[model samples]
Target chain A: MSQQLDLLFYSLSDQTRRDILRRLTLKELTVSQIAKPYKISLAAVSKHLKVLEKAKLIGRRRDGKNHIIHAEPKTLIKIDSWIEFYKQYWNESFDQLNTYLTTVGDTKNET
Target chain B: MSQQLDLLFYSLSDQTRRDILRRLTLKELTVSQIAKPYKISLAAVSKHLKVLEKAKLIGRRRDGKNHIIHAEPKTLIKIDSWIEFYKQYWNESFDQLNTYLTTVGDTKNET
Candidate 1:
């Protein structure tokens, strides 16, 4: 799971890959179409696609000779859950601290 | 911002660092206390702390000779916002597709 997340984050860490993902989120596009806006070579774009594919963030379908790439939004849900876990953990800790402080205040009032 | 996220995700890519973040989330702990549970060397744990610090996921304060490490949950919020942007984008696209499909169904029924 950690390795999967590592690949997912590493794939997203690049500007070009993120751009590709943003574009893919709108609609499925051919490899050439996705690569058209960038100044990088087709090979570079292919490399980015490979990374995205490895992370399962995007899926590729071959239609005749053209490769169609679409964003896999579900993978993002996995990341969301991971972040949510930490968010809840932090919230719980803060609640505990708040309770402790309140108890301390009540004790001082009694004194 | 991409670079900062790259650092943030990169710092989290490792299991040890994630564990450290989890521990810090519970309460502030000294470098020694954080390192005590693991079999690795103190230097190795320190290196992990450095990565977490660079990502701003954890902060250290010098109290006498001890460096107190605490979790900075706000950095996770930045990541949450980034993910939320994509989530909204994908949701909007899905809504558009749903509308189009509904229109197509109505046209088919009218025929």
Candidate 2:
């Protein structure tokens, strides 16, 4: 699981890869179609896709003569779960700040 | 924002960095205190801290002789928001699958 998180985060670290994943989320696309928008070579795009594939963030299905790449969003739920811990800590800090502000407001009103 | 996401995700790709962030979430610690458990040299740990600092996932404050390290959980909110888009897509697919399964069940019942 730790290794998986490593791969998942590493896969998302590149802008091109993230763009490819975002596009795939809308609809499945063939390798060539996926490679079209980028100025980079097909080989470069394929390298990014391979990283995403290794992370299980995207998967490919053979469609006759083409390979269709699609987003695997379910794998993202794990990242969500991991971040939940920190989110809770952040929320607690917000609550504390809010309480402090409210007390300061009340003190000013009393003054 | 895209470049920031790249750094944030890249910072999280390593286990040591993630572990350091997790530890800081509990309480702020001096650089030496943070380096205590790891078998790696202080310089190696400092390298991980530098990555986390560059990402703004952790922050440092000077306290007399010590540099205190603390987790910046607020930075993680951005990642949560990014994952929100994919979660919606995942849920939509789940709903579609549910409708299909229900229709298949109805057909079986009629037979």
* lDDT per residue (tens digit) for residues A1-76 in model 1: 6888878877877778888998898789999999999999999999999999999999998999999999987788
DockQ of each: 0.40, 0.79
The candidate maximizing TM-score is 2
- TM-score, per-candidate, Cα-based: 0.78, 0.89
TM-score of chain B of 1: 0.79
RMSD of 2: 3.3
DockQ, Cα level, model 1: 0.40
CA error at residue B36 for candidate 2, angstroms: 1.1
What is the TM-score of candidate 1? 0.78
Model 1 residue A29 CA deviation in Å? 1.7
Instruction: Give the candidate number with the greatest DockQ.
Output: 2
* Model 2 CAPRI rating: medium
